[model samples]
Target: MTHNVAILGASGYTGAELVRLISQHPDIQIAALAAERKAGMEMADVFPHLRHLSLPTLCKIGEIDFSTIDLCFCALPHKTSQEVISALPADLKIVDLSADFRLSDPEEYEKWYGNPHSAVEMQKEAVYGLTEFNREAIANARLVAGTGCNAATGQFVLRPLIAADVIDLDDIILDMKCAVSGAGRALKENLLHAELSEGYNAYALGSTHRHLGEFDEQFSAIAGRPVKVQFTPHLLPVNRGILATTYVKGDAKAIYAALEAAYKDEPFVELLPFGQGPSTHNVRGSNFVHIGVAEDRLEGRAIVIAALDNLTKGSSGQALQNANLMLGLEETAGLMMAPLFP
Candidate 1:
């Protein structure tokens, strides 16, 4: 009953996370690990935290024996993800944790990513990998496109309200704070400990963040009309979670009721008790998403807050969730670990 899987980009943050998580899967096994630049290195050398587990030595994608892999998780960056995925075996089941195939339109992909898609035909079959919302599609999909971490956090807050028509869609505003890990494990001057510690700043203001494309595409599709929200993302000094504070002009009780109904039966998403809000501290290192709704003193306004480990529920955990469905395995396998708390 075990499925063998391969992980591309095994040296990156998300890739290592996939390894850490899949190591515990009851029905899955990591048969191959690929990290183009770090090929031939032991995964233990690339990520010491995972040294306890016996894992395959990293190799290039071309070196993987696709015939033995039942599923593949690509944790590569945007453009590279598509290029590699396009060249992968057509029959390989892929869960891509990249922005490449999330957008359904090739033109929209070009607009946000600034280049023509290398695999336009592939987009037609890719399912957006927000597990809670796209479970059915993901179960049948060969290629599942994992959402942007910020996009996943925001949707956790807004998707229910939009679908239930409990909020003023045009006036929605999302102020999110994401930890540094969501930027990936790349070295950059801005991400230096000295440059980011004890300080925080906002980027991609004015709805310019690329994740906005996800918001537009998903929200608009749900409403059957154009629904654009004001989204602003901030970089926090911390290393692992995402907190999204959403402002919506709607009855607080109604918003709460809608969210409650939406996630009541869901395993990974928790809707807090009425008038209570969540903190990123509670959901760190777990696949769970904690969401809360508080009534603003001003009538017709409600504040909805959501939190999760950007590395877990935001990316790798989500990819694994979709992989479970795609493989016809239990959806929550290997993902119910309790959040790490100080």
Candidate 2:
């Protein structure tokens, strides 16, 4: 029952991560690796940390026979994924880690991503890959769109609250800090060691972060109305993990109760005790998400926090989780490794 898998963008961080985790999977095998710019090179050359493992050489997407791939993880960048996936075999099950198919509406996709979606038909059929909330749909889906790391982290804290009506939808706010690797492995001047080493700063301020589109769409759907949260994202000096501190107007105990009840059966999401907060260090390099709840001194306000590795649980790990469901494999298989900590 081994599923032959192809990784479309295997040269990047998320793709390499998929290799790392899938390597440990008993029921999944890496059948092909595609990296357009680094074609013909060894994956080990592109990622020295993966040198010890026997892996396929990187090739252009078209060189591989998609007909043999049972499932493909499309880790290509935003717009790039749609084009590549649109041409892929129709029957090929896919877990897309890019932002391409995450938003359902093509108009909304254009609004956030600045371009009309190239694969409108496929986008319509794509299931949102928030593993915990969309388990049933993911199990039956041929194409699953992985959420943005930031979007996923924030929703882990707010979705249950919104669903239970325990929190005021109109006043929700999210302050998130993410490690640089969440930006992707692409080279940028700002991500260089000299520029990003010492201090942290915020970007996409004033409600401009693109992941807000996912928040607006998902929260509104849950509450049956337009729900927009004040979201501001910052880049941390660290290498991995994300911590989202959410402010909501609700009874503290009720918020915790709703979250606990919603995720009581979820394997990867862990809820911390009341008044205790989670740190990114606790979830680094793991597929686990830790959520914490606390009350503000003011009576009607409460705080909810969620933490996870931006690269693992946030992207590649999430893709792997969905792939498991689509293939009828154990959802937690190959993903039960403990978190890496100092």
Candidate 3:
């Protein structure tokens, strides 16, 4: 019952993470690795931390034989993932870690990505891979769209509130901070040590961050109407987690009760004791998401905080979770690593 897996963009952070997790999986085997730019090089050359494990040499996607792989993890860039995944064999289970297939509407995809979706048929079949909320759908999907790290963080705190009518839909606001790895492994002048270290700043303001589209889509759908939350994200100098603090007009007791009740049976999601907030360090390197709730100084309002490793629960770990479902294995399999702490 071991699944043979391939990582299409094996040189990136998320792809390397998929390698790390799969290396420890008892029922999955790494069959192929593809990195268009790093083709023919050993995976260890691209990511030294992975040197201890036996792995395939990186190759181009076109060279992979889909018939040999039970599933593929598409960790390519947004626009690129759409094009690459579109050409992949239809019968292969795919967990796309890019923004390309997350949104259900093709027009919205073009609006956010600034390009038309080249694979409308596949886009229509891709299941939104928010494991907690879309488990059943993902379990049966041939293609699963992994969520944006930021979007996943915010949703863990707010989705239940929206579902239970515990928060005011119009007054929601999210202030999120993420580590540099969430930016991806690509070189960017702003992500350089001299520029990023020792400081933190917000970007994509004024409701312009693309992950907001996911928020709008999921929240609105849950409320059965158009719902928008004011969201702003900041880049922190560190390298691995996301802490999302949400401000909502709601009764603290009700909000706490709703979240606790909603995730009561979920393994990866933990609802902290009321009034106790979470720290990104607590969940770093693990697939677990911790959420906390507290009453705001303003009456009829509360603060909801959620924390997780942006690379793990937010990306690769989530992809693995969905893949387990698609393969009919236990959803939490190969994802039981505890968060790394200093």
**Which one is best on lDDT?**
2
- Evaluated against the true structure, the overall lDDT of model 1 is 0.94
lDDT value for candidate 3?
0.93
TM-score of candidate 1 to 2 decimals: 0.99
What tens-digit string does per-residue lDDT give for candidate 3 at 1-342? 889999999999999999999998888999999999999999999999999999999999989989999999999998999888878887889999999999999999898879998888888898999999998999989999999999999999988999999888999989999999999998999999999999999999996799989999999999999999998999999999999999999899999999989999999999999999999999989999999999999999999999999999999999999999999998898999999997
Per residue, candidate 1 scores C-alpha lDDT tens digits across 200-271 of: 999988956899999999999999999999988999999899999999999998999999999999999999
Tens digit of per-residue lDDT, candidate 2, span 1-342: 789999999999999999999999999999999999999999989999999999999999999998889999999999999999999999999999999999999999999999989999998899999999999999999999999999999999998999999988889889999999999988999999999999999999986789999999999999999998998899998999999999999999999999999999999999999999999989989999999999999999999999999999999999999999999999999999999987
- Candidate 2 lDDT score relative to the true structure: 0.95
lDDT of 3 at 99: 95
- In model 3, the worst 10-residue window by lDDT is 82-91
Candidate 3 off by > 4 Å? none
What are the per-model C-alpha RMSD values against the true structure? 0.7, 0.7, 0.7
